[model samples]
Target: ITYRLVKEYNLMINILRAEVVANKAGELIMDIEGSEQDIAEAIDFTAHEGIEFRILKSGITLDEERCVHCGACTSVCPSGALTLRRDDWSLVFAPEKCFACELCVKSCPVRAIVAVMHLNGTVLAG
Candidate 1:
C-alpha cells in the first residue's frame, strides 16, 4: 500500500501508528502529504482498493464551559498539546501539536476534553 502510494501517486506517507496481526486484523494511522490533486487521486485509489480511512480533525476538543483549568491534563500530555499558562495558570490547548493521543481525555477530571473524529466530513462528538 505504501509502495503504491509512493511510486504511483508520488505521495509521501508518514506512518504514525500501526498494528497488524498477519491476516486477522490491522490498524494503521498515518499522515499523507502531497499536492491537492495528488492527494485526491491517492484517496480515490485507496477507496477503489477498499481501504477504509478517515480524515480526522486535528486534535482533542476542550469544552471551555465545563473545564475548570485544573491542569491535570498538563502532566499526561506527551506532545505538550495541553499545558498551563505561566502567567495566569489557565490551561492552554495547542491542537496543532496534538497527535490525537487521547491521554488528556483520560486525565480530565470534568470530562471537558474529548477526542473529536470526523465521519463523512461531519464532526462526531467524541
Candidate 2:
C-alpha cells in the first residue's frame, strides 16, 4: 500500500514504527505527505486495497503533575514528537507528529505518559 502510494501518487512515505506478526497481520505507524489531491487519491487507493486506515485521534497523554522531565521518554521516541528543551530541560510534546508507538509509555519513569487509542469516535484498548 505504501509503495503504491509513493509510486502512483508521488507521495512521501515515512514509516515511524511497525509491527508484523507472521501469517497474522501487521500494523504501521506512518506519515504520508503529498499535495491535497494526491493525498486524497492515495487514501482512496488504500481503502480500495482492503487496508484499514484510520487517522489517529488520541496519542500519548502526558501528565505534567506526575512528569519529572527526566527525558527518559524522549530517548526512546523514534519520531521527534517527544523532545526536551535544552535551556529549561522541560519536556515538549508535538501531538500531531506522534505515531502512538507506545515506546514513551514504557520509558517514562514516573509513568507520566499513557497510551490511548481512539478509532472512529470510539475509544479502543490502550
Give the winner by TM-score.
1
Clashing pairs in 1: none
Q: Give a tens-digit lDDT track for model 1, residues 85-110.
A: 99999998988888887988999999
Candidate 1 Cα errors over 4 Å, as ranges: 6-38, 47-58
TM-score of each: 0.67, 0.59
- lDDT digits (tens) for residues 1-126 of candidate 2: 778888999999889789989888799977767898998887788788877787655588889999999999999999999999999999999998897778999999889998987776677855
State the C-alpha lDDT per candidate: 0.85, 0.85
> What's the residue-level lDDT of 82 in candidate 2?
93
Q: How far does residue 9 in candidate 1 sit from its true spot (Å)?
A: 4.8
Clashing pairs in 2: none
